[model samples]
Target: MKHEFTVTSILEDARKKHDALMVLVEQNASVPFLYMDRDENIRDVLYHLYGWHQILSDLMTKNPIPPIELRPGYTWKNLTELNYKIKKEAESYTLHEVKHLFNQSHNHWMSKIAQLFDHTLNAAGLYPFTAPSNLGEFIHECMGGHYQWAIQTIEFHLGDPYLRPLLEGFKSLPEVEAIVLGGSRGKQQGDHLSDYDIYVYATKPIDVEERRRIIGPHVSLMEYNHQFFETEDDGVLNNGIGIEFIYRNLDDFKAMMERLFNGQVNRGYSTCFLDNLLTTKIIYDKKRAYKSLQDTYRFIDKAALYQQVIRQNIPLLYGTQPNYFDQIVKAVKRQDIIAVNHRLTEYFSLFFDTLFAINQINHPGEKRMLEKALSLPKQPKELEKTVGKVFDNITSGDFLKDLEQLTLDLIKLTK
Candidate 1:
């Protein structure tokens, strides 16, 4: 609601930023890249202004109001990625060609912006699916915002020349909505031999074959059934650092979260998702929506969370014996590896649920569960040793006894 800038104000701000960017171009001879490589910073600022302008013109006639959040057949979600695409496309041309296209794009954008009515520009809920906003705000967001950021980024890169290469490498990747750094590297908890756990968030799910193509020559894909990145492009090795590629669809994630928040979580299918959402680090958030999601789930209804956990997990844990926990013990006595392991995972889920319920904490995820649990308010006795014991000695004769003791310990703690 606060972003209702008039077209005149929009043009003025854009003109100012555009003027500043050109000064850099003029001073640097439009060769901002090292040794005058691709059209560096200014190239993007101009090209994206052109794109926003072009998309707005097209939006006037699309059937059913095309999702303004996205453009057709292309994956440019916001100014950040749109600029990247434009810059890449501009690479073929010399600085002169690049400037020519930019001028054309800029004029095209200005012509449309000049025709917007105040009523259309300032109205709320201009589009149904998006936030309450109008054309003026959208133009300001995509056009002006890109310029403002580009200048800052350009200045920062000038100070730290090393960063531009890394940024460029990241930009080279295709259809990247966001790139999040997670795991030990993300949380800054790694010692040595820590692989880069990079989560690639996209507008759509990239296929296994297409994903393998854009990968940098430095990193090799991890083997299927690899330790960290199990199957389906579990890893890439860059600069001798193991890099894992975790591709997720932002659209799918939002839909899943909507279903879960609306009481669909009783099925217990998305426990891992909740964990990842909380634990992962957002390194590159283009639309800046992920943080809002984290905030939404940051504090949850403990009683309700417990209810979901108990309803879904109790029966599975307490299969046929006096209780699910007891039933697990019997399965262990029968030496059913498959059942024991399956039930063990279910117990982990239930145990995680129980811990979250007792402490009223959001689930951080399945990784480092016992360590994460111990750091919480009240911890069960021998929790650390028992958790390791469960996995290590699942087939051990004392597995059932250990399970019983831990279950009883949980009862005592919650009470």
Candidate 2:
């Protein structure tokens, strides 16, 4: 509840805390989050803060301080009824709508704050409407204070049992700039089979021994410095939950994001890191650098990147001499099952990149491709059925021809 009231400090704190809360909201929105201290879900918390943000905007902009109510017939004193109405109204909205409304109102309120001078913000009675208290105080309570409360409230319900102790141990290392919960767990879509995919963003590498020493107590089985893909530690928590500790240099990760923002496109998995960052929950951020990066690129326009992703990946699917379709044809001709599977995997990667681009959604990583695609607003009809058929008949005589038709169907959707 404590906050700095200086114009500069309050503004920075407001933005930082807002970004943190947004990340938290995104992480927990998919799951049922009922706060024990109150009868509220995540949407209730979001619309509650959003309602206050709207009030703050009105208070700052309206010259004579127009009458405001918690609802039509309610005042601030009718707190319980006010909250009930708010929650009831929010029940009609989807999670996406509530998040959008909250985010937009915050931005609008911040813009109003930008127009105020320090004297106007920090001095009492300068704005007689907020008498006995300065605008800065109201700003703190509405924006920063309210954000912290919402964050803590939702986090209270969504806390992971093993995450707290793990974060405590990792926080001891100076080299760890930030730590995040990534993959399905971070996205709030994890089932029983899902693991805790932890990403450690560091200034420099934490020695393997140090990592082992830190994570050993919490994990039953631990593997150190596995370079199967990224350099990471593989472990199973004492509670029998699988967790991965993947290391990344903070600076290099920033550079990768910069490249994506500037339209650098990979043949496949073009926006994997972008999706990962947006979906991650900041378990430990030592210097606040990770949150800053999240704020910078959170709303980045990926129109160009999407086009580049489709352009670079779609061609490789077919319609070229050495395309995936042709490669599959040659592999099938040789009756090489391994080669066929390899080409099929690459084919789907390229296929999905184009699919996601055309739909204007970030690629949601490697697992559950058909499910992810099917969830998108726009996608080829019978997509899952076709994909299932291709895989089931991978050894059938018409495999290459079936794949070509599928590629052509996907290409038609892009056009």
Candidate 3:
């Protein structure tokens, strides 16, 4: 029988447990850090985790590079063990000491990735580790997805008050036309709103560079672009920047909202969180802000549905939530076999379903490529056999014997 689970439910449970854990950590006498696992310390390790995962995943299919051997003494364990290893290898220090470490590690990995783009390496390397040519398009997926997870986990456990102020600051910007709070918390379904995911619509199309200056140093801007209203036959609107800016004024904004309400207007494809909601916040009139807020809520409800479809179809690219695979490894280390088994099943099911959905959605020309990349066989029975083999491997305890084994298996399979 197939197991059933909803992302919303998992997020909600994680939030509740995280909140409870935070309270315990605060009131307890011995624990020095707010989080039991010292998650902050592990940021560097997390970066490396992402790097290795991305590299190994590419190696498995595209380039087939020799697999890197896992270091000795590392083994599968519970979340605590993973955190301990991260902390142990990490330079000793308090929260203050590690604040810069995250950035340093991030830059280090980025630099390494940059090297893959060098002209000499581009042609010779087995697989380039850098992001795609359209970096702007992909960066949001990386930052938004990961940060959403990090913020949720941190807010649940750390209780940071800074989140609200950060959001309020964004809201205060005059240029922002609509702001959508995406994620598990947007619908108030018990998912923790850790990081603020704000979608700021400007009245005028600002140049990417200009938008950067406007957003300034406080917050890092991910992706910004001018969107054109278009039609299938007439083609995209070719209005100049000045005209586009003029069209974004209060009157045009109201007209746009009215069209949206009457089902006469539609926005382009967006992978953002707000797509799941049914409606969105509209700021047509400055005096009637409350009405705009109501509309915004409905718009978001509609958008949420869209988000669900995207997740269902897309390859598992990024997640901020504690790496479920890593968590399983940690559980094994702590000798929590039951917990490891349960989580492993949950994660395996999610991945399988996600990949299967991607296969179903494959475009005509891309079907063969995807099928080959995913190792799907031509025959239905063959596909079942392959899936069964994967399940058996997951059930086997050989990978759980040590960190090295676990990492190797994960790198091989997840890739």
Candidate 3 lDDT by residue in tens digits, 275-357: 23322222122344434434463323333333343344223222334655567666766777678778765554444333333
Q: What pairs collide in candidate 1?
A: 219-237, 317-324, 318-323, 318-324
The candidate that wins on TM-score is 2
Candidate 3 regions exceeding 4 Å error are 1-172, 175-178, 182-197, 202-210, 214-254, 260-415
Please estimate how well model 1 matches the true structure, expressed as its whole-model Cα lDDT. 0.61
lDDT of all predictions, in order shown?
0.61, 0.78, 0.37
Model 3 / residue 197 / CA error / Å: 6.1
lDDT, model 3: 0.37
Query: What's the TM for model 2?
Result: 0.65
Worst 10 residues of 3 by lDDT: 231-240
Rank order by lDDT, top first?
A: 2, 1, 3
What stretches of model 2 exceed 4 Å from their correct place? 1-158
Q: Give the residue spans of candidate 1 off by over 4 A.
A: 1-175, 206-213, 220-232, 266-270, 299-303, 318-323, 337-339, 385-396, 399-402
Worst 10 residues of 1 by lDDT: 31-40
